[model samples]
Target: MAKRSIYARELVNLMAGHWVARAVYAAARLGVADLLEAGPQHVEVLAKKANAHEGALYRLLRALASVGVFTETEPNTFSMTPKAELLCSDHPNSLRPLVLLWNELEYSAWDDIVHSIKTGECAFEYRTGSPFFDVLEKDMESARIFREAMAGASRLIPLAISEVYDFSGCNTIVDVGGSHGNLVSTILSTHPDLKGVIFDLPNVVESVKNKMGDEASRCEFAGGDFFESVPGGGDLYILSRIIHDWDDEHSIKILKNCRNAMGSDGKLLLVEIIIDTNNESSFGNWLDLHMLVMQGGSERTEAEYRRLLDAAGFELTRIIPTGQWQNIIEAVPASI
Candidate 1:
């Protein structure tokens, strides 16, 4: 019976995850969390403001309440929980963009996971008629949302990197494909002696410039294609969650670009999830499937990273584990 109960619990948990995602989507779409930012409100009042049915809204909130997303002080009144507060749009680490993107793009593509299993091709392009980046390029609104989502996801990475890695000896650090310069800002803020460069496409740099502010003076923004070239001469080139976005060929191109741009004494720091073959339950493995469905990339093992770095003319130096499940792979230019 214990075994049966465990199976039942797992089944319930899976269903609960779906329920939570749908609830989050509804809250995001209706701006419920944002509306409740001031205080709690009656269900009818919230329903009326959101143009939703009163009884349905109550039921929805009740479902979310059971999961601890919201709390019910009275029968039909709802208030935000610490968990639900993260959905608020104004929050610096808001999950709204993530919810929107996952539901809009990843969720639908995920429905065709069998397609990936059978053919080993991205379900996104198979379903959407274009690659993810290409689709984002054509749709400005989606592109902005995607960029914002990336920025939000990156909010913690810089701090994690700063805490885990030693940047004492480094002077100039280049953040390759650094979106919004958040990671660069975090690094520079931590290491007062380190001046940094945020390198990405022109549009990405433009979008982030205003946010950079005074740090903009210390940090240089270089707009160019990573495939074509990277700004040279930095002692450290940081690629945070960058390599997992491409296949080996393209990943090699970007790494080689960094390698070429590096000074003889330079190091390349790749901040990413390193998959362990021995681990059964790993987020990196799940993300590997996500990459297959969305971006056609794959999370790699440390050995794979070593091989890629070697091919790109870099010597794999050290792998430092961060506070999170991420690891920073430090590599240096191969001896001539």
Candidate 2:
């Protein structure tokens, strides 16, 4: 017997990462975090309420406990760790929806990861026989979770972005493809004078229309396809986390529509993960693979974004880093 080298240990950790993700998804799907939110509970209690086998649940928790997601309080009792608390549905920055959404997306797609890489086709579409958005449209429950997931990921950015970028010049902010209106709500709340128009698919819009909170009075909701038209006459049109969900052809169509909707003074703000050429460890670089597997999109570099924007009749202004999960790429309609 011999001690394994650090490289081998690191590789092992990397290989076992998916096991952790799937296990977390199981806990989320079972509403385990919500059940444990009050306090510690016996495995039997969790299993009964979760409708899962008691013995299997215990084994799952024990393995998750080893990873600090749960703490074994006693022989068979457990409580959520700080990390696990994030999976609670009511947590302000809850990752529960993301966990659920990712699980739904990856359940089949990840199994076809090889096909995605070799064929340059979305693994999800390969297995499901429909595009991701179409599937979301058909399944109302999954659509709701997807909206929550996007807003949960985006809600933190508005706070960080407002501190760095001035929105005072912009009289109206049109949130294109805004899922839950969380981003626009935050922006309106922060800058009270600015009006917001949240646009998404009709079903999506209807679901999130009431989610705008105190700012609802100043906001309007519209439902339509961005490829056809965006809500016109907006000073700042935001395509937050939208471009990364489609290939260049579709993305350009959406951008061109936005460009057509804007006047010369209008600015287009794209919030997304910008992949870096230098770092293999970059989060965006890894997510680029996820876009390929799940959405048939790829995260882009600044240069790539510039090219894409230019093709759709816009000029890249400056990219602002919000010290969070994404950066804001601001562009204006290009001169004729």
Can you give the TM-score per candidate against the true fold? 0.93, 0.93
Off by over 4 Å in 1: 2-9
lDDT of 2 by residue, 231-325 (tens): 88788999888999888999999999998888888999999988888886888887898999998998999999999999999999999998997
- Distance from true position, residue 203, model 2, in Å? 1.3
Best by lDDT: 2
Lowest summed lDDT across 10 adjacent residues in model 2 is found at 1-10
RMSD to the native, candidate 2?
Answer: 1.9
Worst 10 residues of 1 by lDDT: 207-216
Off by over 4 Å in 2: 1-5
